[model samples]
Target: MSATTDGSRVRNLWDEAKAATLDEPGKLLYRSNLLGSDKRITNYGGGNTSAKVTHRDPLTGEDVTVLWVKGSGGDVGTIKLDGFATLYMDKLNRLRDIYRGPAHEDEMVGYLPHCTFNLNPRAASIDTPLHAYLPYPHVDHMHPDAVIAIAATRNGREITRRVYGEEIGWLEWRRPGFELGLELARFAAENPEAKGVVLGSHGLFTWGRTAEECYATTLAIINRAIEWFEGELKDKPAFGGEVVAALPRERRREIAARLMPEIRARIGRDEAKIGHFDDSDAVLQFVGSAALRPLAALGTSCPDHFLRTKIRPLVLDFDPANGDVEALVAGLDGAVEAYRQDYAAYYQRSKHPDSPAMRDPNAVIYLVPGVGMISFAKDKGTARVSAEFYVNAINVMRGASGVDDYLGLPEQEAFDIEYWLLEEAKLQRLPKPKPLAGRVALVTGGAGGIGQAIAARLMAEGACVVLADIDANALDATKADFAKGFGADQVRGTRMNVTSEAEVAASFAEAVVEYGGLDILVSNAGIASAAPVEDTTLEVWDRNISILATGYFLVSREAFRLFRRQKLGGSMIFISSKNGLAASAGASAYCTAKAAEIHLARCLALEGAEAGIRVNTVNPDAVLRGSKIWSGEWREQRAASSKIGTEELEAHYRNRSLLKRSVFPEDIAEAVYFFASDLSAKSTGNIVNVDAGNAISFTR
Candidate 1:
């Protein structure tokens, strides 16, 4: 329990953890979430944790501090940067203190700090104060089963005293919010030496000087408690088992984002963190149960969790005997109704004329005997935190009670926690859509080929696009087509070299001024050359990279600057060739340049993903119709190279694909739209191919 034990080794480990987190935060976050996944340290949207970073205020021109907490309902085990809410620490502190000293929590509406770039993120966490109160630069709050095992017992206070000897204090479980904060502050004052604290029948709190210390302490605390309980408590009959499978990060992110759409829509918050869990038999049993027997508790870790999580999770009612998922779903549906009725009844009982009653449990943990717990948030962070709390609570109880003594608060106590005014105040903030509208698009090489197709698509999808091409006549003609299809306001024409930075900058400035915002950039301009590596000329190499690789950097930089000034999260697309994926005979520079563009797209994607902007690449193989590559002269040249009729070359390429059809700009365009649309809300740093059958799989 002493942090100083093996101080040097711990410091070395923490230093390494800090290096990794600082060097590769995105990687660290995903890996951490993956590690916490499966074990149920957090559920769908139950908990959130954050590290404080210093920043300066743009308006005040003053130094200020900011903290990024998980977005509302995001799965902590699966959150990315977007899942975190960036709030001014000063503003957050004020919000927590405004109602202090006899002010009724609901008497005054609490104004939460806005997100960066003026976003009014809704629903500050139930545990926001708890997160802020930690002396550590980083804070980790989870509903760990081991911690919760301590929290959920009638003898929690006594056990905590015996275990930590006043090093940690216990808060009577209260619904999380201003009241929870006020109570936690009091506890902190009383226990000056405390490194951790337990909320009776709620969860645990821990913090450290750095992120690693926080993570390690959390693991140590939970594990220590687990060891204690295994020694002291009776082992229950084994039920569900752990999956122990490692889901790819992409898959996990996809799952979290998919589950959190509604919550994100409402809160304008992203969890910004993804955690993996370690699965144990207890977690599986908790999640696997069809019907949560009366033995299971009905509350979250604390009142504050209501903000991070929902009122309660949808207690999945399942029957292990049937094992029919549909039947299990039906049982869950029945359980949901009963839960709703109970929630309604609880609200009525808890409602005071002055306090509003919460409609449901902010989160509901399923106690499936064999299935692991699943938490659902409006977003993933919430779900993950809730799941973690359940996991920890289960662990804590397993250790605390030699008998299965998990306790749910009585209706009266549950009512007090539910109707706590301090918690309700946190929910008072308004949420808004991500402000990225009114953006203009200026695409390089956006005429007479795949570029033109991309330009047309961007125009149709709300961007006023100026299509640029080296071919002046082609630009004009394409503008006319865009006018016919979308409208005059949606399309513009320009003639410029993709390789010219000055031209790209000037064009970008003009577009921004004319359209009021230049937020989207499609660096889809490039020329192709076919030659072997040795035969590839300096001229070909330079020109190829100049138009494709360098062009993307030039054009994207202009767009990014425009977006920063406009305070918009822009979107970007790159048109990379299928050659980017594979080398072809007689096309060295082209393939190399194309591959470079793909890599550039990834770099840009990572940079732009958190900017409320998207970056992606489209690799199309032989999209020969209406493209310059398929223009009369080029087609004839290709035909000559193959020693076949131009018509025969088209057929050969068409038949070569798995789909047995010629790929067109339209084929690539559809996939581009998918990447651009709300449908691709989470697809960044990804390459989607629209190459008919594409010679083979798009991903290796």
Candidate 2:
């Protein structure tokens, strides 16, 4: 144990962990989970772990030494026994002997796959050789923020000597490959008593006789580095900028909202990109700082971060003094284009001959001064992850800067890691993305069961969503809930009373600001009413018409206006009721309003044809399992009107449909997704009934 070690704590955890897992790989998995669970040690999948073990070789009938290295693309936090690629140590050592002069990136990558002991298809990490070359039985390598703070500093070597003396070996900047492996092994041999190796401008490496020892050594090294940094860099500088305090928070949100949609559009997939603003104090400090551009230009804290954040963040210049939307959009367009050009140049200058196709040119992160930072990705999940990684990088850079000047690998070196075949393999493994990759959508009554379902579906298919509803509490709660799954950047909530033109107009304007522009609008804010035509009062009928009929008109009218402005052919889907097409007894007001909403959609379709806007309707009946529309009087009235108990009435509706299944919110959401995507590109002004195959509800 070193200076930072807490032996009792490590011993206790190890005792508990080892008691649960008697197998070696299982024990290694437990250790990996412990390391990965701490974000400070590794962000997302930025690190790897390994152990040396013996396994029976079926062909030779003898125990062989195997290198159990973490598999490529697996997060150590949740990695399982299978997540480790079992490699033959002797074969890996043989390949190392033949690695001569300059190590070829592709050759090393190719050899890794075939060197596995069990012919395991899982790709070993690119750093497998580095781990294999180590003499210890257990090894842990990580890019902890504290370690990067020192490694990325100007005086990294001197700092390393001052901290660990001859106990740690330091290697100059060498890209992760066979060469790095050789250099680290040579350094270890030269200094027999060295506790670990600190890769210059790279990361930390530690080894021990056992997994527990190695794990403890890593924590000790990290704690010492962090302690040294805190002691030496006592006075941290405050973040300052030309306009950090000059701009208002509201303006920052407005600018981010306005600029994001266009930025997403310029990146050029059909659906809009999801944008997240990291406006926390730390984020604001870094993004708003005067040194942001220069510090950000140094590149990511480590090369591994390049996978999630790219070489650098996209920084945009914006001022609230001038509010020309097009000009702002054009500026974002130019910046995005410049970023792509830079990426191409970076690729051409340093890419290996065998490197895979260049990754998406768009920067995953965008640094907005007044608005903090906005991260973008093809989907909500990635966008959030990118934001998290960037935030961590920002803090690391800040800490590094507090001491000696912060530094990272040169551009060419970073490009080598960014385009490494092993890294590219991770993206290739993802399932084909949804077609609506760059679209933004708005769902009214989003707090309702059907609206929530629609928002979930839209996000699942790669669209950012704005949830608008009159119930402020419900809207906020739903937004928070959805954000956990879809990302906070992709999901937002706005209080909107659809019947009021002012509220509708404001909500649409907010959508335009928040998402840059709108692509899909779901006019689903309506209430259910049931009464005989003679018994219907003006209050009941007007209330129903105002919500079901006029609400659709107001919302659609605003959406159409914004769609024309953006000139991106959009979709407007109305969630009318099955009662609209097939009148239900004693439900005169609800039926009439629903019928009017359907006709309104048709009229809008005709009007929007030239503008490339497609309007369609989804007629769903009795989506009552979670629907707010079926509560209290409406449910009782409908059951009484049908001359049956509530349960029997529900059963009658279920059996009435040809499919004999209840029409649920999810079923309607699936139909909505169809119209929103390219599947209904040529089809508009049509009503798709989602009432469990109810023939009577169908409309041509």
Local distance difference test scores for all models: 0.60, 0.80
Candidate 2 residue lDDT tens string, 1-700: 1111253122224565453666767778878888877677777777889999999997898999999999887888878888889898888989966675564555777777777787787778778988998888888988888788778888888888888888777877887778877777888788879889888777889888877788878877877777777777666564334445435777777666666666655664643565556677778888767788898888885776766788898887755456454676677757888999998888888877788877678888888765677777666566677777887787678777887788866887787777766657766777886776667899999999999999999988878889999999999899999989876767878899999999887787677655557889998887887888999999999999999999999999888877775677789999998888988788899899999998999999999999999999999988887788886687888888878888787788898789898888899999999999989999899998888887777675
Write candidate 1's Cα lDDT for 1-700 as tens digits.
1122232122112346545645333433643464245343544455567777666678877877777666555667667677666777777666654565434544322444443423635345545666665545666677665667677777788888876776677778665556666676677667667877887866777766666666777666666666566565544432222223323433323322222222212122231111222235556554543223433544443444433434455545444444444565335435655766776766776678877745433234433333344443322233455555555455443454443455555566655655666545435543532222233567777886787777766655555677888888888888898888876656677777767888876665445323334545777776666655787789978888887788778887877665554344656778887789877666777778888988888887777766787888888887777777666555665567677897798788877788888887877777777776667778888888777776543667
Query: Compared to the true structure, candidate 1 yields what TM-score?
Result: 0.45
Backbone clash numbers for all candidates listed? 107, 6
Give TM per candidate: 0.45, 0.86
Q: Show the lowest summed lDDT stretch of 10 residues, model 2.
A: 1-10
The TM-score, computed over Cα atoms with residue i paired to residue i, of candidate 2 is: 0.86
